[model samples]
Target: MAGFWLGPRAAMRGYRLFGYDSIGSTSSEAMASARRGDAGDVWFAALQQTEGRGRRGRVWESPSGNLAASLLIVHEGDAASVATLGFVAGIALQEALSGNLPASALRIGVDGADGLTGQGHAARLALKWPNDVIADGGKLAGILLEAQGLPDGRMAIVIGFGVNIVAAPTGLPYPATCLHALGTPVSAEAVFAALADAWVDAFELWAGGRGVADVLARWRRHAAGLGSEVAISHDGQVVRGIFETIDEFGRLIVRDGARGTIAITAGDVHFGATATSGRT
Candidate 1:
């Protein structure tokens, strides 16, 4: 990773890389590259993102020493098919982090990610539905997916990863943790180096939507709050229920007492105690 070269597998697949010490947003850069007709299959990574954004237009902080990366793929297929890549990304991020985390954090399971310490104890790692990696209930990383149509009936899809390697943002609605905070201090570059390669493994498993079932299975194994109390806020309505399994297409399915089975296409999800906190 001297010059941000990806893992051998990625390189073999002809994937390219562009590294920056600071940038507005790696995802934005990826789309720009696509717009310029630069054949995709490239990753744009930056150490700092001054104008990063999260799902639903939330500001994503990417201070120096954190990892902000976006992978652009020039894809020809239905947009629905490409959406499954989000799960693929969660799997890759988990695999990369599990490989890079301190052995102490590689225990049977990580219950939460926030305010954790590596004080001679093991931790569990899990994925919060859709696009987040967590230790216990604390958020360690997040994913954002974006797509733009090209004139050739194809699309430029960018899946972005923002990880807290050295520092986590403050005052978020939920807890945020970083490698340093977990006592497994590591450089953002090192994380990206591992993540770049891990993406190859997970992406291959996905096989461009053909193997999504397997991806979904792996995702389920590491999913958090699957059988826990949950709340989803959508369009001024709050749906409270048990965190049921995700449907085949990856939509979250909630089992409500009086509402039968509810399939949530998109919404802000909260779990356990937070679900009843009257917040979206």
Candidate 2:
């Protein structure tokens, strides 16, 4: 087992650690650990994943040299607390990465015509609310939080994280970008080290009665969709609106005039320019 840290400040806070060299899917492995009743902060990490997964049952491209890991946290709080996992993970990862580089230089997105950075005065890396990390309009990392219904009227959540460290796969469902594309090289060990610390910090906040509102605020600070016109597709219906806030329950609030303000709990949100008319 390789080394893992709870945080830069705190030691392991009641978490039992599990590390692996390689696995089929970190999410699957973490969920298994939860099922066995060993459910503190368990992390499943591997140098390579043979069969990784993403949202909507999509297969994640988990080639070698990327970060494929998942954290299984047993629900001890309410449903809202459980749902904040994704937002927490996103914030954690962002904090971890920011510590390594200048905030502006670390921002993820496309280089302009003259390869100049955008006009955000404060160094900003936007997020695709709920579960995506974007820098400059391209995908930096994707997150999927799955809950397994236990027999005893309980559920275990597995937070799966796929980050492009060395490379991002081409010809995928959505246009993929990696840290390398931005001239930054991320190592697996370094990524894991920062992630572990960030997770502990995020969960601690949730445990302290911060609620989803706090998560929403942090997410919006780094979100890619705020104030932008976008389309959200779910169950064959499409709604286009100016991206708005996420409510306390973690639902997206979209203002589309005719539809008023629609709360989107689940859907594929496509930003404009790259926006699709509907789901593929």
Candidate 3:
């Protein structure tokens, strides 16, 4: 199998790729390259990850044939602004998956929390807060961001993406699904090709923080749990409210009626009536 294939946009932008049949971690490779003073704008991809990691250092099961990749870029911005990359990644990834999936399998419903059997479609392709892509309320893909300040005063940001194509891991907090489960046999290469192009457009729209509103508008279009019951777990506190909106800065905004509106910078969000049962 080929190591990597760059999309038209990626090629035009001079982005490089290092594809591996199997590897430890794409994100780890990106970090090592940055430390070696390699310029950014490169992608690290692999067919399998023997020691992959998820958010909060959880074990990311990267079996063979799954899509595990990372991008190393020189992103210069304040800490707050840099954090928005996660949102950008989410929108881009969702777009990529949308392009690769059949329209019939996707429907705008709950994020697939407790199974959307009655409230219309079960769950469509949606973006979860922070950095998760869901289909039918099960986690389809995830994004992880890490930043390192270089000695040259530049910031190297590595954005990692893991998509469940042929298979989805088991025993997760929430449910999990893959392309095959949705009746699609898409390959990792195909997914990466679409993602390479989608990310370019999304990133350009972000415009280094100048076009946040535009970027967020696209995100809201496919966001789940809007106007529904939402429970956010943050910093040892559980906050319940209605899913209001995401602010321009990418904060999850929840309205709790009596407590008014709350802006959440980080937390685990559960929506719909099954929100109360979304415990690990």
- Model 2, 1-280: lDDT tens per residue? 5443444532456654556666799998898887888654677776578899888888888777778878887775656667777888888877776565445555333321011124545344556766876655566678899887776767788988888777787886556666666666767767777888888877777663465567666766666656667777778887788777777777888897887888889887787554534444
Estimated TM-score per prediction?
0.91, 0.86, 0.92
**Taking the tens digit of each residue's C-alpha lDDT, what string does model 3 give over 96-174?**
9988777565453444332222245533677888788888777889999999999988899999999999999988666
Reference-based lDDT, each prediction? 0.83, 0.70, 0.84
Instruction: Write down the lDDT that model 1 would get.
Output: 0.83
Candidate 3 TM-score over all chains jointly? 0.92
The lDDT-based order of candidates, best leading, equals 3, 1, 2
Whichever of 1 and 3 has more TM-score, that candidate is 3
**Number of backbone-clashing residue pairs for each candidate, in the order shown:** 11, 7, 3
Per-residue CA lDDT of model 1 for 1-280, tens digit only, reads 2245587778888889999989999999999999999888899988899999999899999898899999999999798889999999999998888877664543323232222223523235677877888864568899999999998889999999999988888997777788787777778877887888899899899888899999998888777777777888888999998888988999999999998999988887788677766665
lDDT (C-alpha) at residue 80 in model 3 = 79
- Candidate with more favorable, higher lDDT: 2 or 3: 3
**Which candidate's TM-score is highest?**
3
